[model samples]
Target chain A: MSDFTRDEIHRLALLARLEFTDEQADAFAQQLTQILHYVETLNGLDTTGVEPTSHALALHSVMRDDEPRPSLSNAEALANAPEQEAGCFRVPPIIQEL
Target chain B: MTDAPAYATLKELQRSLEAGECSSRELTQALLDRIEALDGKLGAFLRVTPDEALQQADAADAARRQGRRSPLLGIPLGLKDILCTRGVATTCASRILRDFIPPYDATAVARLRQAGAVFLGKLNMDEFAMGSSCEFSAWQPTRNPWDPTRIPGGSSGGSAAAVAAGFCPATLGTDTGGSIRQPAALCGVVGLKPTYGRVSRYGLIAFASSLDQIGPFARTVEDCALLLNAIAAQDPLDSTSAPVATSDYTECLGREIRGLRVGLPREYFIDGMEPAVEAAVRRAVADLAAQGAEIVEISLPHTEYAVAVYYICATAEASSNLARYDGAHYGYRAAGTRNIIEMYSRSRTEGFGEEVKRRIMLGTYVLSAGFYDAYYSKALKVRTLITRDFAEAFRQVDVIATPTTPGVAFRIGEKLDDPLQMYLSDIFTISANLAGIPGLSLPCGFTAEGLPIGLQLLAPAFEEARLLQVAHAYEQSHDWWRRRPELA
Candidate 1:
């Protein structure tokens, strides 16, 4: 039996910073429960003492000399901004007045 | 379109250009006209750039006039929309970045440009490369050229469809988990997903960073090799780019495969696969065997766990990569929001499609405080086991062969409502990405209904030369590469 629930779905959406309608959330909850049920098959395998492989290559932290180079100008970087003011991206206010 | 030669391979196109039979401008113009006439029903291209293409074609012609000849010079190609192109709208078929215009070309795109390949325009894909069928695209879904009622397997559906429809000689595609191979299989074209880090990924829009790699789709094994030769190079811009040297992949086209050993994994030839698909792939392997190639039965024991492992790892990376789209940066922003949090949440909810949201939420759940070790960490350990399976199998065989998909192309809406079934579409192709090996898909045979079946050839990591050699041998011995979809 799957442990997924509607409350857990809502909690996940909140953590993901997504807003879903009640109807959408209901549908998603059902679908996700089914998918989770299918993926639970992985738990059947015995994988003791196995080292996790996060990347295909074995390269460590790659670094270059600390030097300035040409990059996108402010105008080019902000070219696709939905809203901009004073060469900066503009967003809704983070704080609210009481 | 009448002036365009009917040569099916990019190598033939190169020969024609070198011989001055037709100028690059003429070939580019005819293809542009064909796209204008046929693309409405196919829905392959989201945008077409005639002016830029003509300008590049003219320059290629001028370069040829100076007696310089290169394999990809003066060839017109389509780019999957996920690859950023300067001054072109590089939407990954998502409404969120529908208006986003990149300021620079992706490393692979820049390499193709330097190699003198003319760009037609941006192609469509599944939203954020998240779906198996192209139906999740914000634009109209790309229909298979072989049958308009069926899907061209995605998220590289548009790339495969455009090439199959003859809109261009070839195109670039990205595959994380069978996006390139599955679509190419369904559309009856050739697709190659090189070893991870074989091609640079600097400007490709992030989906699953660890799994995504750019590749090519073309009509013939040789054309795929030509395109791979141009774009497979190391770039400092991409930290994950492999430092290994690039080789002329075309040079191995006619290599003898008489002494080669091919492996057939017992796990892949199990029940539930379509009868016709299995028969076609078996016949192809038999054809190679008759040519003196040896076949060995092998076991990739952890194959059953690929889907679970892929979804966990891909979604986890996707959730982290996509956190940058918070409505404050470039892309869509929700209007009439009272606070920043509301702005971010509402914008994403309205901007992303259903599939993207599902994966995002699933990723969040797995990586949550209590579930990390149970889900994400466990998946990583299982992933190592899967990789080891491939390593052990490669020791006994030079290449592994399997059916690219379990069956032929399903109808457009066949699996839309079932996410689990859709993920299963990539069952045969995901292990390559997980193990970071190279894989190729080309037409082996077709069903009685005329839909194509693909035979996949996978090689050890960085052994693309061996993979292409075997594929080219099989392709030359068969007539499947000569057939094209009769699009009206």
Candidate 2:
């Protein structure tokens, strides 16, 4: 794999929904490259036609019986909101307007 | 009542309570006082619930007076901060979650509450269980009870240190990548990581869903088993919780290890490991063999690739799991953001620690369009090989024994600058989480510096009974764990 460029680091920071100053991005670019190189050690063994094990247990999609249960109340659900309106989470407006 | 009950095992405390030697209020108060006096020096607890604990203790006493005899009634225990407690602050040692409190308890916490367990408080951990050392906690680092200057290991360092300091008999900790076992080793206690689906994960703040399993850190293997017994159940809320045959884990104790096959993985004792620590584990395995257990050499050749595969897989999952913290719903949010996009990114940038952001960046890169196949998908296929290696190893042996960590506890800030070196600390213990098996760590011996060394044992899934049996046999022969840390 080619070395990760500063542009690629900037792209990754955006993709991960994080912001970094110039210095922070530089440090992360170097560190992430080192870590990626380390993890790339997995390529040594050829896994030809091997099935990827997603979950350790052979778990079939488990469905419980269709039953009504006590779910969290609306107030409880919105209890920890950083911004809250009338029984709902308040968020910044889209389309460049509030 | 005497203050000595503060350090008694869960079993001993249960017996004392049943024998009417002391009231639950007395026991809880004594431990609360002890925590008040000592926790400031140790930095083990993030929050202590003296009033709530006393109320629970009083209720337990009332139930006992009316003849209810649950094993965990009035037993005080601490939880790793990642597990949500109803109405109690559940910070995963990150500023992002510094003020988040759940409206309901985690399945494990709920079960413990039903078992009449008293909640002393939540313990500290690495932020979102991301790092191997407790120094990654947004709060202060938890000191080693054995030597206050040294680390107690992480991200369940506080859980292990609290148990070691005799603040509580046992505490709950999560092991996604050796978080529980590594700290248990460093803190001179017993820690168990059950099979991935053995315990319900309804309210564990996810770090890596596929790898994390809630387990116990205790002063003894039996206490670990007791805690497991209370929490291990198939929950409807957690789809991944397996509907497997359940054993009363406490009942599995005291079984003979005679004729049990133990496998020693050669790759585990590699050169970078401390020779004295490895020798301590060797002596532990020999004692198991001396008790009529057969020792066999085994090769899990995919062991070398575990740390690499784990960092990829775990980070990739963490990147997705942590996306919910975008400043809208809960937790910390960057203020004065003119737009939603800025709100999302800036909130995370200011909220998370250095290691968390790095993992997120790496995860995003690997899962990006040009790199997904080369990194994340390849890791899954390699993960299959790593799992199969254990399947093959288990075919010949009942359990695998190794050092929990390559070395004993190091001083704080030792590996903070070198992230690669810090990640290598969980080298031996991560593969078990990768393969989704049960792993246990017990205090095997102490180093020349008197820091405790851990002996780790792994068993196949749903064989927690066998795991506890072997661990109990080995623990019975050694007095290494009986020595407590002198905090005064």
Candidate 3:
């Protein structure tokens, strides 16, 4: 059986950085429990010694030469900011004062 | 201009424009007027850019006068809202990016612009391309053009509806686990999800980076190929883009399918499928056989696990990709937050829809410390087995054929409350995305209730040319493409 409890879902929401109301969490927990149960069928497969396919293409470390090219200007980059100050994105205080 | 059938294919419009029967501006105006009349009922388009479209049309007309001709020149098309348009709002049908207008165009959109295609507007979709039905859209649910009470499949619901309702001749849609094909199937149009990396995903809002691919929706197979020719290209900006030569997809449309090998996957024709859908697909197979194509029975045993694997992989990627939407740089920011943590959490809570949140949570759970190996890694390993299943099957068959969807379009809100049931809607189409193969869905038949049924044709990776050829042969032999929904 899937073990998706409300508290587990709350922990996941915290990790995901999204706030969910109790009602939302409760409903999602139930649905997610059902989904987890459904996906648990994969455990029945004998995937021993099988390699994981992260991407369809097998290319590794696709890197271009270290060359600078045109990119979004500072004004354009800051254009979509909800709050901007001194030509930089303004955010809530990260380091709290003692 | 009024005499022109609004449901005319893109090729028909091209012919008319070339023959001087009507100017591009006149066609654009007529289509814009039609959208004004019909889209209110269909909810297919989130916005309509008449002024910009008309200006583009006028420029196309002048270029035509200067003896410059292109297949998509002066053609008006809608874009699934996920693609960023330079100065246009690129809402992925979510409240978060409700007013997020990008400063750049998606590479596909820019290529189409260069090919002279005119933009009608951004179309509706499942919020963040998360739902199979369009009902999850933050704006309004897009109704299927065939039947108003039914959903036009999604997250490309608006693109399919627009093509079906004749709001535009063609449109672009992204498929990550069947968004393009399912909707196209339901609406009786053609939708193609090219091989992953076949089309650049430079500016497409990520939904599942490995699986997401931008493709086209049109009334006919030929039109789909034409749109593909214009948009399929290698882009330096998208590192995953295959640096291979692009083909003129239209060149293969008229090719005969004689001596072609089509595989019927037994796993797809299982219980719970709508009888009408199965019957239509079986009939299509027979039709291809009659056209001198060989039919072979095949097995893709891992087909049942596609939904499970898809959910785990897609949600994991989506959880990571969507981390940028924390009310920091762009998109909607919630008010009344005490600290940065509260600000990030509250903004996402307010911005995303229930389905998006559900997937995000699921993704987080699978990728978490204790469950990572059990869920996410297991899913990735199963993904390899699934891909191997296709690779083995394709060695003996040129293309695999199946019913695009389990059933015809369901009524709005019919399956909304059941999330598991909703995920099963993409069972057949997900494997193609997972395996990185080209898949196309085209109208094959209609049910007794007059709902359209789709026949899916999937080709090996990068074998879109062969896939389109076989689909075109079947399409040319049928009268289904001639049928248009009577949208009152």
Candidate 4:
């Protein structure tokens, strides 16, 4: 089994913005390693000249007209907002700087 | 009601409607009532559109009165809440859009609406279709109708549960990986993930854009086919929708499976698969063989790498697709954000569930400056190998057969603590998504515990017709598709 350390797991958690306890982090480290090791079985293949297909079929080329359409009024749009101010969605200060 | 109409096949319901024994309004209200009765315990719907559904059912009854009827006419269906519906809440089961109503309808929604089908409301799902179990939804976990303590498989868990519970006759779901088929297999419903681009994705919230496709969840194979006929086709609005030939899928049903080469992947019968699932799947294969299908043991050697490669590629694409939800344009915005970064971070932090956030971070990491090739690019190369494996295997077999999941529905909290274990549940179904192949999950047998088990039938990409044919033949001989959850 691969040794996925607690530090690495914590780093990944940081990257992932997850607030995990130390115990949770340890568990995740072990689980992720096992899962990755299990999935490593795909490494044993010969994939020459086979094109990777992102979509099964070719999509239509046409684009819709960029015409103006009726839109939800600001009142209707924010009608369900948890919090709103001055016809806009209220939010915590975005950037402390800039 | 004669034998719980929810368990009846789409053809049976259509026949009943056509025979004038029951009006479309009656069926629609029956489902609405069913949802009202059980939704408190099941948590299947995020929103229930009783008034709108009644109005649409009246229209359908009027249309049928004039002898203008289609297979979908008067059918009551549910949306996965990920697809936009005009003036209806399309939350994607996230708090961000919990109250957000789209000003427009998705191509699939608009098509189904025009076909005279009634909407039963939005079904709960994983936040942004991210989790394999419905536990991840911001609302509440959708309980398996068969056993309330267990989860219905997910991120389309709500759709699968609703169909199995008879909350709606059928539902629309989006599969990006194994969201549709995996849950269907777990819940004992039929779910079809059409080959990518076969259906329009416009107005369906993006999860992993490259892997995502809108699909159907129904009570039986024929119902799935009927729904497919209504939804699948070219849509100019979605640039990625294929302009393919639209043949009625029902035409291919009820055909014999004689001479069809069914592939049994030696690799899919992996070490950890439960003995019960194995026995059930083997019995399905034997039954298919009895029905004159030739079972071939085909080896797709690269099957093992599917989960990792799918995670990497899917996450990378998701990172890009979800960048649109950065609190700028639409969706939920966290309050008191004075600046841009705080606005983006706080909105995302508040709006997305833990699983969705984790995916976004993993996706962001894989697509970041230094590690793209090691993770994303290499995964793409591995994806190519996996696809080639399917192509090579299909050369000898017309379709593939496998146990849809490693085991039947585990308890709701069984794997919730371990995300990796949850991810492994999709292993059998993900490769088809990776290869952009069409796959279906149909009820084959019940687990020894009496929960339903599903056998997955996979067809080469765009070969939905063949998949339906195989499923139809199986349904004819074995009437397991008629089984329903006995709710007290």
Query: Where's the lowest-lDDT run of ten residues in candidate 3 chain B?
Result: B1-10
**Of the pair 1 and 3, which is ahead by lDDT?**
3
Clashing pairs for model 1 are: none
What overall lDDT goes with each candidate model? 0.91, 0.91, 0.93, 0.83
Off by over 4 Å in 2: A65-67, B1-3
Model 4 ranges with Cα > 4 A deviation:
A1-98, B1-4
Question: In model 3, which runs have C-alpha deviations exceeding 4 angstroms?
Answer: B1-5
Please say which candidate is ahead in TM-score: 2 or 4: 2
Measured with DockQ on alpha carbons, how good is candidate 1? 0.85
Evaluated on the second chain alone, the candidates' TM-scores are 0.99, 0.99, 0.99, 0.98
Which candidate would rank higher by lDDT, 1 or 4?
Answer: 1
Q: Write the per-residue lDDT of candidate 4 for residues B1-488, one digit (tens) a residue.
A: 33356666677888888899888888887877777777899898989999999999999999999989788788788999899999887889888776687878999999999999899899899989998989999988999988999999899999999988877778999998889998898889899999988899999999877789999998878889999999998787777777669798989998899899999999989898888888989998998999999999999987878888888778778767877776665677777766666666677767877777667656776676776755676777788778888889989999999999998998989998787788989989899888888999998889767798889999988899999999888877887767778776
- Per prediction, fnat is 0.81, 0.89, 0.78, 0.36
Highest lDDT against the true fold, candidate: 3
Predictions' DockQ, in order? 0.85, 0.85, 0.84, 0.33
Cα RMSDs, all models: 1.1, 1.2, 1.0, 3.2
lDDT of 2 by residue, B309-340 (tens): 99999999999999988999899999999889
Please provide TM-scores, in order, for all candidate models, with all chains considered together: 0.99, 0.98, 0.99, 0.91
Q: List model 1 lDDT by residue over B316-370, tens digit each.
A: 9999988888888799898999999999899898889889998998888888898
Off by over 4 Å in 1: B3-7
The predicted structure with the larger DockQ, 1 or 4, is 1
